[model samples]
Structure formats: C-alpha cells, structure tokens
Target: MARGSYGRGVTSTRTDRWLRLDGTTNTRDLGGLPTVDGGTTVRGRVLRSDNLQTLSEVDVRRLVEDLRLREVVDLRSTAEVLLEGRGPLRAVPGVRHRHFTLLPERGHHTDVFAVEEADAPELPAGWAESILPRQVAEDDQEETPAVRSYLGYLAHRPENVVAALRALAGDGSPDGGGATVVHCAAGKDRTGVVVAFALAVAGVPDEEIVADYALTAEVIDDLVAKLASSPTYAEDMQRRDVASHTPRAETMRRLLELLHERHGGPRGWLTVHGFGPGEQDALRARLRDQQPG
Candidate 1:
C-alpha cells in the first residue's frame, strides 16, 4: 500500500481511506484495512468521523445517498445531544440514530467532550479529578494518560460499549451492506476507542488498529480548529494544546496492550461485557470481506 506523511512524524497507508467532505475533516471509511486472516475489511460497512453538526446538504447526500448510511452510532453525551440538537441528518428518512454515551450520567448536564484539564474552571468541579486519577493509579504505570482515559471509557460504561458494538455488528450481511458511521466531538478519543474495538473484533491486526486510530492525527489541526469554532467545544479546545490532542500510535498501542493484559483482548472484553460469541461472529462477518478460494 502507498504511504503518505500526515506531518508531526506520522505516516499512514494512503489507501483512499479518507472520505473528503465539505463539513468534517476527520471522517473516513474503515475499509481496506488488512485483517488477521489475510482478508481486508469491506468498504462502506463502517465509518469513523468527527462531529456532523455542520454537514452540508451535499455532505448529507454523499453520506445518505452515495454511501447508503443506515445508522449513526453517536457516542456523545446527553448534554452534547441536547446542545447540538439532531443536526440535518435528523430530517433524513431511513437513517437511524442511536445514542450510547460512554460517559457516566451525572444527573446534571456535563460537557463530556470537554478537555478535562485539572484547572479548567468551566468544567464541572471534580470532573477529571473524580475519574482520571483513580484510573491511572489502577492501570499499568507505563500506560499514557490517554490510554488510561480510554480505559476509563470501558471501565465506567461497559454497557454502552457493548451496545455500540452491537450497533456496529448489525445483522451480518455479505456484499458490504449498508454503512454505519460512528462519531463523537473530534472522533479521536471516544470515537477512536469504540472504532478500535470494532476493528479489533473484525480481526484487524493491532498495528492496523493503531494506524487507523492515528490517521486522525493527519487532520488533528483541522479537527481541533473546527471544533474550537463551536460554542460547544470552544472552551475545552482552548484549554488544551493541539499537540496534546494528536492521536499517537503509541497511545493506541498501549491501550490495545492493556486490553490484552487485563481482559484477554477485544474478544475477551466483549465476551465479559455480554457481547458473547454469536454477536462477535456477526460483527466480524459484518466487517470482514470473504476471502477468495
């Protein structure tokens, strides 16, 4: 596969994985990635993206008509949904939207997408302090804070994770059936974790999963800038440096390693969390292309 530089010393396989659109910079099809069994993922079966609040009508047509997007597995919090409303896709027929927020519901509205800097006053008190430190102390000392944060998503909300996986699996259909797009605010952290699990279940190698996660780094600046312009994410974006937000391969690599160490890998984690073998097979079948005889 041809490769290209995404700056910041990150180079990704240039397989036309990126889905260029007028609204978002980080949207890409999770297709053509090499799986463990020597088969590649089917194109258009699943997509990972940043926010869709600003998608143009043409963007909608491109996704809804051209891509045949059947479901949107939004990983945003209740506050985000309430603040962003449903966007234009809400009006589109035949498209289903499912919200399975990976954040623990705190009764009051919290900006779950916000950069949980220790001193960010705009964030609810004890937001980062409450969960992050504990997660870091419990996990491997070598794990990056980002890795710990990703684990926190699974630790705090296994039910949501299982639900999101079920949504991705969606009735095993050959011929690369209708697509499902998963997104959060910037499609880096929350979206990356969920998509990583799905791809892992599909038998994509750990390096491939890390590479796919790091692809977001290629457009990290664009994603941050776009979200920074929004009232919803502006404060959080301003609080953190852009470099800190770049999705490093090491971060995801450590995350996958931790999953392996703790839960016996994605399959093990899914099984423990109620996804079970039948559902796992469905998801694998949904995302994997049939190998030739």
Candidate 2:
C-alpha cells in the first residue's frame, strides 16, 4: 500500500488496483505498513514482487524511475532462468540486479516436493481430526509434501536457510536514496518465508509481516491461475501452494506459535535455526533501530 498514487489500472478490482505489471507475476511494494513502533516502514525503502522475465518498457520505467528501485534480488532457479529467458532491465541508468536461488540446489527441495504432492488439498481443519489422518496414512507417506518437504526444508537448516539469509543480509543498503526489491517466481513460498524474515529484521510488527505475507496472494491472483495451467504443475507445487494459502490467517499464527512455543519469538526462531551471534546482531542492526520506538 505505498500511498501517493500508485495509479490504478483501467480495471477496478481492489486486487487489480494493486497490480503493477501485467506480464510479470506477484509484483507489489511493502510500503505503508505501520511497524511495531510508531513510525512506518519507510515508504520506498523496500518493494517486493515477482520475476522480471517479462518486464515491458513501461513496467521498467515505473520500477526504476517511479519506485527508484536500486537493486533487484531475483530468487528464481537456474533452470527457471533458462526457461523464462530474461531481457535487459530497460536501462534504468542506475539499477542493479542479482539472482540468488533462496532454496539453492534445486535437487534437494524441489525434487523432494515433486515426489510428495498429492492430487488434492487437505480436508478443512476441523474435518481432519476425525478420519483424514487415517486416510492420509493409508494414502501413502509420499502423498503429503508438507510433511515431507517441510521436513527437508527444515533439514536443509544445515544449508539453505542460513545461506539465503547470509546473502540477503550482506547485500549493501539501498543505493543513492533508492530502495531494493526481492522476489522469486510466485513470491509466496520460499520468497514469502525469506521476505518475512527480512521485514522482521527491519522492525516490522509480527501482525504487519503476516498481513504482508497474505497481501502478495491478493495482488497476484492471476499468477496463481497461471501456475495451475503451467505444464510442469505437480502435486508438490499443489501441496506447497496449499500450505501457502492454507489458513489465510492460520499459517502465520502457526509459525508464530511454533516460534513462541519453542524459542522466545521470531528472534528466537532464528537463533535456534543456527544464525550465530555476529550474524544475528548484524541482521538486527540492519532491520531495527538501537532505541526501541
């Protein structure tokens, strides 16, 4: 919700009003949020969106000039990069772009997820209590990517998450008064999780972060439709997308709950996840002010 007139498109869905790029998927800025403290997450300091694969001339102008975007962090895989075949970012004069597949090594996470996705979504929460567990057990362990992929996602704690954070944390601050935008293909699963951590570092409130996580889906409904039609679509993508939109509000609550139940809070979640002392403080300094606002 970056205030100051993000010119509404000719159409008028509350969702469509937020749409920035037609060809590019899941593009939206994380502005206008009132952080835990009094001040807001400085508008124009950060923008989040999808791939730059299909950025048009107008789209590039808006991104580089209007938004004054300094850097673009693309989280898509090498294979996806080859498939999509990107073009130059329209010579904005000063913008820089870099790619770092968040869950690096496509072999581990994506491979495991492809084998785990089931044909359909899980039963509604309350219904699962009665017989879904038994149904799932009988259906086969391979049918549940959330159980399998999430485990591998967590297991890669040894590699992926920590490495992704390091890359993000090390990126130089926004250049010459411009902001930075980070995104992956869909901008919901891996991108969402990592961006959530980034906002947390920036001192955004937990509620605001959750709201932001949900916001990407609202703005990029078309991408969801496209993914459904994608030739490579599979069960794991279905399961991951299912887990992604699962609760609307439920997933965020659950992540926060798990963090609280085990460690102290989001900070605790990072500590336990193997982000060492120096790394933790550096991230905090980047995201939070020394004095509590």
Candidate 3:
C-alpha cells in the first residue's frame, strides 16, 4: 500500500528528508504523487502534516536541514495555533514560517480519516463518524454541523484557499521558487482539494489526481485503529472495509465532479477563487514534475 512505501520509491536517490517524529501518521512528503510528466515532487521540497506542535528533535533535524524547507505555513485555524502551537520551527534553519488560517473560527477535524471505528457497519451519527461525508458530501448542510461547516468553508472561504495555493506556490516567499506542501487537520479534504488543484494546474490528468486523493485513507489506518480502541472515540469501527473509514470513494468522486461541473475543472475553480494566470502558473511551478529541482 502507499502508506508502507510512501517516499521509499523517491528516497533512494535522496534521504529521509521529510520523515519526522511527533508528527501525525498522515504526515508525509507529497513528492510521491506520480505524474505523467515523469518525475515526482522533489523530496524535502514540500511536506504535509497535522501540526508540528510535538515534533521531536529528530523531526526538527529532518525538517530544518535534511529537507532544507525554507518555508513553513500553518493552514490550521487560529484556535488550533493557540492549542497546538505551530512552535518556532527550529529545524530547517531560518525557515520562514507563516500562518494562514483556513478555518479560523471552526476547529478543523484533525482525524476525519480515522476510519477504524467506521468499520462498524452502522456507526452512530457521532462527530467521529462525520469526517468523510462532512468533507465530500454534495448535499446541503442543514442538520450536520460538521457537514455544514466543512462545506461552508469550501464555498465561502475561497480567500483562504487561494492564499494557501499562493503560499504553496511561494507566490511571495523568499525560497526563490521551489517545492511546497499543504495540509489541514487530516491532510485529506482541505489538503487533498488543494493538492488536486495544483495537480490539475500542472496538467496532470484527473484519473491520477484522484488516485493521489484516494491514498489518504491508507495513510492513516493506525490512527483510526487507535481512535477505535479508545473509549474516547465516538463509535466502534467494528471491522468494516478500509475505504469505509475515510471519505467514501463515491463522495470524493462526486466532489471532484462538482468542482469540474461547476468550475470547469481545477483551473476554473481557481479562477472563481480569483486565481489569475500568474497564480495558476505559480501553483503549476510548485507541483508540476520538477526539472530536477
């Protein structure tokens, strides 16, 4: 599965640059997103994670120097920063850290993909069970707070999304144009949407962009397991299929379909968010198979 050998394929030439301790299980280098263009994202150039609050010393070393990540962006909400503290990025010396909150008032669900409990065929409509649909559902949010909030973020918060793209592309950073990463709580929905947009901008086909999108469920099976056993968890996953725990494949597919149907694919979506040709190009530069970095 992609989780086991994530960066291994690209790391033979490079080292474990983005590998970090204290980061969430879903955190990993986006360099593995295979492209028709031949190369993948350069290792250490960009990474995604829940929050760097608990990053260990080794994690710091990998991020600060090994990855040489020049920029660190916090896509979490303001409350999250207060609770989690993105922490002064010690690794990756002089790493220009920035905070661009995507969902400021609402606390982002950190582990929506923790599907271990979703193993239960009829999991209760608890907060824990809301991760996937809240993100990918096409229905309007009338009763479900999680669903409403997540969907509202997408429809109303184009600015944050745009800012995120600009940041990932380093629209105004000092990295001199290089690799970048984006993530929100689970690194599935918000992060996935952004990455798909970048990939679409890079001329990657929807089939592959979706392939990359579907991989997040596999990325965090362990966390879902943990959440399942803990009494703190809302429901028991009860051994259902793996895909059931994350956003339903059909749910995600429908969201992509909506993006295409409404905005004419990723580019049109970006344009609706006010992404001009220049910003679109910036996104392309960041995610498009690099010319050997």
Candidate 4:
C-alpha cells in the first residue's frame, strides 16, 4: 500500500514516520531520512518494529496485505523465542521468517532486550568491557546503563551483529522488495543497532539516525504497558520502571560516536566483520530511493 493508505491508528507525527499499530508502539518505516548525497531512504522498503507476538488480526492483515511485508528479521535470543512462541505473523504464507539470535545462547531467558545480560560470558581479550559493573565502578559509573547495553552489542556478539545486518540487507528477502520488518523483544536495542547500521550504510546523518532511535520515547509508556500485559514479558518488566528501559536520544548519540571513532562507522565495521562490497551495495540498493524525473 501507498504510505498514506495505512489504517486509522497511523499517526501524523514526523511526517508519517510511525506505523502506529494497536499491538505495537515502536513500528515505523525507516524511510524518508535525508542521505549524505541529497537523497531520501525509500519508503515501505524497510520497517522496524517491536515484538509481534501480540499483533491483532487486523494488524497482521494490514502488515501483510497493505505493507507487503516480505520478511521478518527476528533478533531475539533462542530462549526468548522458545518461551514466547511465534507471533501472529508466523502464519502468513508469503512472508519469510529468519531468526538470528544476536546474543549467545543461554539456558535461561532474561530481559536481554531491555538490559544487558548480567550473566553473559566475558568478552574475548581486547573487546572493551566498558559496560560491565566492574568497569562501571572503576570508571565511577560514568557510562549510563543504556549506553553500556548498547556497547555490549559490539563487545559480546560482533559476528551475530554482522549477520543480523546482512539479513536485514535483503539476505532473507527472496524478491528484494525490501518490506522487511526487524524486531526483537523490545524492538529498541537489537532492532535499534541493526537499524542504525542499515541507515548509516545508506549515508543517513548521525542526527537523523539518533532522531529515529529517540522516536521510541514517544510511545514508550504504551509500549511498556503492552509488553507488561503479556505473560512473556510482564514478570521481568515488573522488576523495573519503564523509564529505565526508555530510549534516550543521547544513548544513540553515544553509540554513533563509538561506531565512528572505534569501528570506523558502519561500512568499516561491516567490512571488518566480512560484509564485502557486494553486500554493502545490496543494502544500499534496498534502502535508497530512486531519483524523480
């Protein structure tokens, strides 16, 4: 469907940036962002959303029939998916579902989406442990919990991180229509990191990327409430307030800074992790819009 043709709950905020669904608060098109070369990201090609387990029938229909969803890039851990089960979208025939757990496999599930796994194994030598509690105390706790959690994406699972980006870049889409919806438990961390890398590859400015990340702050309350209402996430959410899990614009800011300064930006990071020129071009093609006549 055309962008404006989306159903009633779709809000007018930020020029149709959000895909407001009754079941999800964080779903939105990763399109129309200004690129470095004076272009815009293609609309309806790439979407980012939260957990799809609670989607209503209407919501699923809208996503399938209207959005032309071609694939789903689920970044949740194995344990989380096993505990929560496949969501409403699992039954859709045309859409492809590819699961790539971004974190290490564990026997028990934790709120990995909201916070870093405290029991996660130590990083290999040379990977910064800036997010660990010991590092936090040594540094006077200068790093916010959110920033540490974001950094952990790099420290703990760089290989899976690269794979997740490849999956989003059309590796999982058979036809390359680009209507891929990527989500995790909260759709803000793993989703955010992968989306950030995708946007950076498309040459979207850091500010715009940060803006998109902060958009989650708009519906955080309702999003948290929805997750809390579900049996899968409610118990864990009760232990913490929504604000602690809320996305802050600054968190993304710091992440981008780290990406540029440490990993040499998205392209550098991807190249180091085994995504070559062909992979990069494919991702760019999926996100960038054609010039108008």
Candidate 5:
C-alpha cells in the first residue's frame, strides 16, 4: 500500500514478504516458511515474481545488488520470450538467465496464446470435456481446471520442469550463495507450480506451499492491471475477470495431493523425470536453511 523507497535505489514498498516494485506487482521472497522438519526456508535464496520485462533500474539494483540475485529461471514459452524479448536483467553482469518453458515445444502448444490459456478464466472450449476426462475419472473428479493445467506442466514438458529445478539448485551459481528468482507472466500459474515443487523439495509443509501460492491473490488486481497495460498480455487479461486471476489455495492443495497420489511426491516426480537423488539433495540444500543443533 505505502509506496516508499525500500533500499538504495529501489523505489518500492514492502508488504510483508512481497517486494513492491515499480514494474511488477507480485514479487515476493520465499523465505522464513516453515518446513516439515522444523527448519525454515532461508531468505534471499529464492524469490517468485511476475514478469520482469518492465523492471526499472531501481528494481534491477534491488534484485541484483541488494538481494545478490545470481540466477533467473524463466518459465515462459519460447514464443513469449521471443515476443517480449529479454528484460533489463538480461544485460546485467553476473545474473544468469535460463529459459525452461513448461509447455510442449511444438504443435498447438508453442505460443503465448497457449501459455495464456494455462491460467485462463476457464478452460478453452471443450478442453475439459476432451483432454481431461481420463484424469477426472481416475482422480475422483477432484481436479479443478487449474489443477489439471498445473499437472499438464508435468505431463507436457517434464524435462523443462526438472531443468528449472536444477537451475534453482545452484547449477550455475558459484556456491549457491546468491538469490534465484523464478517467474512467468503474472507469476500465478507456471511460476506457482515451479515454486511449489521447489518448496516441496525443500521440505516445506503443504499448507505453507499453498499459502505461498495464494499470496498472489493479494496482488491479483494489480497484477492483472499491470499485464493488461502490456500489449502482449492485454487481450488475455481483458477477457478474464480479475477474480478469475486470483489463485485459489484449494487448487494448489489438490495439485500437491495429486502429485503425491500419482508420483509419490514432488521429489519422486522429479526423480522419475530424471532429476535424480543427488540433484534433489542439492536443490534441498540450496533452498533450506540449516537447522540449529
């Protein structure tokens, strides 16, 4: 709410963990969240955000200099990246950028339009009736369209998902010392799913993961408004009511439940998808704070 300078050149306000930036609406530190084993996630290690295409110089300084960000895991499709171009962070020295889109690389799935549909107010016409009936029949109809979309990320481009996790696990970092920001458009669906899996691998509790995903709702209006002003996402944002953009906790909860039901858990899913135990441990080590003896 309050708009003041938070640090050095960062002209933004702080709303709890949310980093109020001049360009982005839903950027927050994934720190101090409780894990199942009595540990908490360490601050400055990971952050989740919406688009960074419009980040001001001050915002860039805050993320790179102040937060010591070393990596950015961009989850947007190839078309989204080509259309939007890399943002300000791309030119900054020492910050690595990796694009691991969680969508099919070809056919009907390789465009910004299809990426937008992942979080559309409703499933595209007949989508639920056609592609998702098997999941519905198998999962007792517990999957919301949003949940199904999230699961589709696993089914569609699981390698990208695992690659994103590996990037977050300090793959390119000097010693896993700097922060990594994971983001997609609006930072609600793709970013949320990836962050959820990262936190799950870090041993964060299910409720905390869901609560973190739902935090996007607090800034849903601003997020939608910001994207609506952008030419690339304007049409999609204009078509959907703002309420439809607000993420529901139950959607994330069910996603996690189904992940466990079908794949043992996030860790198991990652393992099955080729992430392996060593990589999972590295990711866990990168995300979790050391518990006191």
Candidate 6:
C-alpha cells in the first residue's frame, strides 16, 4: 500500500491511473485509456474519486497543485452532502465545486433499493431479502448486484445523470477549466455510470471502460469498511455482505449494451438528452489527446 500503489492484488500499466490520496482509495485519473481512434485519453484532465471529506492537507495540495484540478462534479444526493457537510476542497478558491444529485431526494438511500426491489423480483431469496434494510421475498430470477444497482440509477434518475455529463463537458467553472473530478460518496455506483459514459463518448473501447469500472473492485473491501464506519452508509452496508457490493466488469459491459440497444449508444443518448453538437465537440476536445507517434 505504498503511495500511488493501488493495493497488492490488481495490476495495470496505467502510469497515472491511481491518485493515492490519504483520505480515499478509489480516486483515479481517466487518462491514458486507449481510444478506438488510436489516441489516448488526455492525462490529468478527468479524475474520479470517492468522498473528499477526509482529504489530508497534503492530499488537497496534490489535487490543486499537482493535478491542477479545476472542476469537481459531485454526484451525491442532497441528503448525503448535507449529512457530510462540505469537505476540505469546498472552501478552496482554485477548485470549482458543482452539486448535481444523480438521484432524487426521495430515492436517496432506501428508495434506490425500493425501486430495485420492485423491478428486480428475480433476485435470490437471501439477496433479495438483503436488497433493502428489510427483507424482500425472493422470486426465481437472476441479475448481478452491479447490474441491479446500475439499473436503479437509470430507472430512478436518468435526467440528472445526463446533466452531470453535460456539466463535465462544459467550461463554465468559477475558473474556466478542463480538469474535472467526478465523484460520489463511494465513487463507484453513480460516478461509475457517468464516467463510463464520458469514456465511451471519448471513444475509449468497451473493454477499457469495463477495466476502469472493475478497478473499483481492488479497493472494495476497504471502501465498504470506510462506508460502514459512517452512519450515512452504515445501514446500506448492513443490507448485504461486502463481497456482494464489489463491482464486476460484466456489470459495466451489460450497461454499455443497454445504452446501445435502448438509447442508441453514448452519442445518441447524449444527443437525445440535449448534449448538442457544440457540447459534444467541446467534450471530445477537452478529453482527447493527439495520438502518440
């Protein structure tokens, strides 16, 4: 667990992949991912992370000075932020913070699972029971936990989800900026979906997207423990085993397909949701780097 070392088990050649912040294990740069057009994602432009509430003084300096972070797209619900208050980064002058609740207030904690329980009647008895704070009587159907959770994101709050991307693509920060950090409480579920879409739009292939999504798995145990330690996520943790909460690559894979089949892929979905030609071009320019010769 050296600084910049992303734990022991996982391996990658992504040179700037993990940020190694003292407060969070899940922070990573969405850079150096291979795009379909033979280019790579621009290094230091987009970073994703869990909560920043505990970022050490050194961590804040690294983000501001080292990473040149300018915009922070916070995807947590109003309740989550109000409960946690502003993290250290909130008061910083150089960084611009934007709050876009990816989930409606009603669906903040239990309501997300409530929607999942209703739509996913096929979960195994024990898992379905564990779906919410209370047990859900199971039916004989099957869906992975990651897929179910993603579906809940789409089902519950698709509008804010699209808006979050649009904000990341634009340059309307307190300071005009491109280096944006997208994050939620854990930076796994809601942040994963939004970042997945951003990468897809940048022409990063499906496999790479899945790899980035699955990277969260490496730190799942520690993330769960961190969440469980807080009252904000304690009840959510009590709902299931930590293993069930770990992310799987296939979860993102299936979600990509769902976007393709249902919303006509990333470009079409964004277009339909009002990310017009101007915004699209701006986003690509902001994220895409020239192909290394």
Best by TM-score: 1
For all candidates in order, the CA lDDT equals 0.77, 0.52, 0.54, 0.72, 0.75, 0.71
Off by over 4 Å in 2: 1-19, 88-93, 104-154, 157-177, 228-247, 272-293
lDDT per residue for candidate 4 within 25-122, as digits (tens), equals 78999877877677788888888999988889999889888988878888876556655665788778788777766664433323333333345433
Per-residue error at 104 for model 6, in Å? 2.6
- Model 2 pairs whose backbones collide: 117-235, 117-236, 201-287, 202-287
In the order shown, what is each candidate's alpha-carbon RMSD?
Answer: 6.6, 10.8, 9.7, 8.6, 9.0, 9.2
- Candidate 5, residue 148: Cα displacement in angstroms equals 1.3
C-alpha TM-scores of all predictions: 0.85, 0.64, 0.67, 0.80, 0.81, 0.79
Best by lDDT: 1
lDDT of 4 at 37: 74
lDDT of 3 by residue, 108-159 (tens): 4332212232332333334343223234345564324433454555765677
Residue-wise C-alpha lDDT for candidate 5, range 109-196, written one tens digit per residue: 3433234435423323322122222233455445677887788788777888888888888853323868899999989899999998
lDDT of 4 at 143: 74
Off by over 4 Å in 5: 1-15, 107-142, 172-175, 290-293
Structure candidate 4, residue pairs in collision: 45-178
Better candidate number, 5 or 6, judged by lDDT = 5
Candidate 1 wrongly placed segments (more than 4 Å):
1-12, 108-137, 140-142, 175-177, 290-293
Model 6: worst 10 consecutive residues (lDDT sum): 1-10
Q: List the residue pairs that clash in candidate 3.
A: 64-91, 64-92, 117-237, 119-237, 119-240, 120-237
C-alpha lDDT of residue 280 in model 2: 55
- What's the CA error at residue 163 for candidate 5, in Å? 0.3
lDDT of 1 by residue, 1-293 (tens): 11112224223346498999999999998888877666888888899999998999999999989999988889987666655656888788788888788876555433332333232224344333222233445435666778877887888888888988888887665443588999999998999999988888877777777888888888989999998998777888899999988989889887777678778888888899898878877888888854211
Rate residue 291 of model 4 by lDDT.
22
Number of clashing pairs per prediction, in order: 0, 4, 6, 1, 0, 2
Prediction 3 TM-score vs. true: 0.67
